[model samples]
Target: MNEVMDVIRLFLPLIVVQLLLMSVALFDLYRRVSVRGQKWVWVIIIIVINLLGPIAYFIFGREKSSEY
Candidate 1:
């Protein structure tokens, strides 16, 4: 139906963007865990805390560059 199609059109973009953001965050978490030897903690955090886990990882979990 036309109404269904309209709803899909509006919702599709938002869904796509949300998926992209989640994927990006998960990918970043994987990279940080792999590189820093912290996979178990990061995996637990990512699964248990969801979006907040990645946000925290981005803020504090990454390995700091010594050059700074």
Candidate 2:
């Protein structure tokens, strides 16, 4: 039980952060008009790729201001 608690304590913050990031990404994805590529593709990437998925969406998926 101690070992399990230790593991959970260490990973709990990460899980929380990951969920937060994913939710924000999904929300942003839903609100945007156009991203760098297909909306469905970004949704799949955000849902399936874990932490990096949302980061990737922010870094590469979103279009530049000049694009609009």
Candidate 3:
């Protein structure tokens, strides 16, 4: 029905946004965990504490050579 289609249209963008955010978080977690000197425990931190995971990565996970 037209009403169902309209609801889907409205919800699609929200679904896309959530997926994008989740992807970014996962990528950040992988990068942080792969650091050479750092322990792998941070990956657990990221998984159990979602917001803190990315924040810790940004604060502590940056390689000396890369800005991101």
Tell me, by lDDT, which candidate is best: 2
Global lDDT of model 3: 0.61
Models 1 onward score TM values of: 0.52, 0.90, 0.49
Runs with alpha carbons beyond 4 Å of true place in candidate 3: 34-68
Q: Would you give me the overall lDDT of model 2?
A: 0.93
Q: How do the residues 1-68 of candidate 3 rate in per-residue lDDT, one tens digit apiece?
A: 99999999999987676555546766765655255345456555555665566556556755665533
lDDT per model vs. reference: 0.64, 0.93, 0.61
Q: What is the Cα-based TM-score of model 3?
A: 0.49
Off by over 4 Å in 1: 34-68
Clashing pairs in model 2, backbone N/Cα/C closer than 3 A: none
lDDT of 2 at 52: 98
Q: Can you give the lDDT of residue 22 in candidate 2?
A: 98
* Candidate with maximal TM-score: 2
What ranking of all candidate models by TM-score puts the best one first? Answer: 2, 1, 3
